[model samples]
Target: MEAKTAVNVGQLSRKPELKPKRKIKWKNVLTYAAFVGPALLFFVVIQIIPFLMGIYYSFTSWNGISAAVDWVGLENYKKIFTNDAKFFNSFWFTTRFMFAAVVISNLLGFGLALLLNGALKTRNILRTVFFMPNVIGGLLLGFIWQFIFVKGFASVGKYTDIGIFKLAWLGDEATAFWGIVIVFAWQTAGYMMVIYIAALQGVDQSLVEAARIDGASNWNVLTKIMMPLILPAFTICFFLTISMAFKIFDINISLTNGGPFNSTESVAINIYREAFQYNNFGLGTAKAVLFFVIVAVFTTVQVVMTKKKEVEA
Candidate 1:
């Protein structure tokens, strides 16, 4: 009995100890939930819910205020496709404006970047000056430019006797289109310039020096080496300009109010009028949906094409 008791004690002593697993702290999870919950709630309430509701309302003939909302089943879209002349015209105008604005803004921005990339004494100050216009709201900028076009240009023309400045810039259709382009480029080019300058600074200076040593001219160096290196910046700038120009509203409204027989009216302005002015919420929502599709497709195509060029480069 003594020997058996001793053996049992030894066995018990040799056995390894085991510990209980720790439970997950629900407090930490609650803390994270407390932090992230409100933002998610607001995003859903503000953006997602409204967007989904707009989609539903697009198929209904709701006047936006009354409780009566009759389902129309694509009638709004059908009217837009078959009978909306003003909307189509505005769409065409917007398309043309987008093309012009993108090209001019990118070119000017790139040029400014090149000029500022050099060691100029006043480049920093000039960059700040150029970018200042972008800080102002588009609506405010439009109003400011309106005064310049109406009074300031007239005053300058009166003194300098320049026929170009004397011409009715906002009153005529062709000139109004170009006028908007000029203001848009002026406002946006600075922002693009800042982007290009950053990209330009990232270019390999040794490659440029090697090209220079190989008897390459400045033009060739820019075209062959710098352009390829900075293609990504071009892609970004083009995308931004395209999106902004496509959905332009404030500047168009404050500048010309789509006057001169609504010649300079954009698709955005048309949608606003359709919804608020004419009280056609369903049609407006339908136009908005179509606008969204066009913008998505165009930007996607642009990004894909530019990305392919980037890989080739």
Candidate 2:
């Protein structure tokens, strides 16, 4: 009896312990899916699918409405590289415009932020006034500026007799370029100012007080301390301005309409004319791809450089 009991006990000890498998909680998963499903569906449908179609179209000789899209391989790209003079000219114009607009807008924005950071009675009203232009659509703003450059400036020039104002603002190439720059800066500066103001407000006031007590000059404090602390804001503002300036289209269209012998033509306007006006969808898509590459590269470099400075500061 004792030996049989020991054998049973040994058998029981040798048996493997059973554990329950973890069941996937479908309820929790479904809850998360319910939240993320719509946005993910829209993103895939709207952005990803169109982007893929654009890439495919870039390789074909599709005239946007033809029955058949004939694959041309690298022909379009080859033409863009070797045979497209106007496209390259538009690219050059875009580059120059971007540099001018970015610098001027950021300077004005940062200056305004500094001025308003102080305890001014009218700061709230001034901020509202400055930012009002940004609330208006770019097309409307462009039209408004166009009117101002034409009739309003003509009237002001007539009264003041200023030669600068008297010059045909949108007719002459040089003046037209500067005129666009002025309008772009005016419209965008306020947006940048608001960003800079948020960054300025977050900065430690104690540091400024301590620097003042130490007899640090305003310039020194600004350059050494405040600028470093606000480096992230500069990064954000520069990135915003760079992208906006590079992709400038609506304002460029409504303001100048790429006029004066197409000297003021932007890459976006050029792309539009090529695709819709000229009915060369393949070539336009190719140009658009190149434009995207240039913008991506430039903005990436800018962000990387600024971030490095931010880390150092």
Query: What is the C-alpha lDDT profile of model 1 across 1-313, one tens digit per residue?
Result: 9999999999999968789889989999899989999999999999999989889989999998899999999999999999999999999999999999999999999999999999999999999999999999999999999999999999999999999989899999999999999999999999999999999999999999999999999999999999999999999999999999999999999999997799999999999999999999999999998899999999999999999999999
Model 2 TM-score relative to the real fold? 0.92
Candidate 2, which segments miss by more than 4 Å at Cα? 1-25
lDDT of 2 at 268: 97
10 residues in a row with least lDDT, candidate 1:
15-24
How does each model score on lDDT?
0.96, 0.94
Question: In lDDT terms, which candidate is top?
Answer: 1
**lDDT: worst 10-residue window of model 2:** 11-20
| Predicted candidate 2 versus true structure: per-residue lDDT over 1-313, tens digit per residue | 9999999999988969789899999999999999999999999999999888988999999999988999999999999999999999999999999999999999999999999989999999999999888888889989999999999999999999998779999999999999889988999999999999999999898999899999999998899889999999999999999999988898999999998899999999999999999999999999998899989999999999999999988
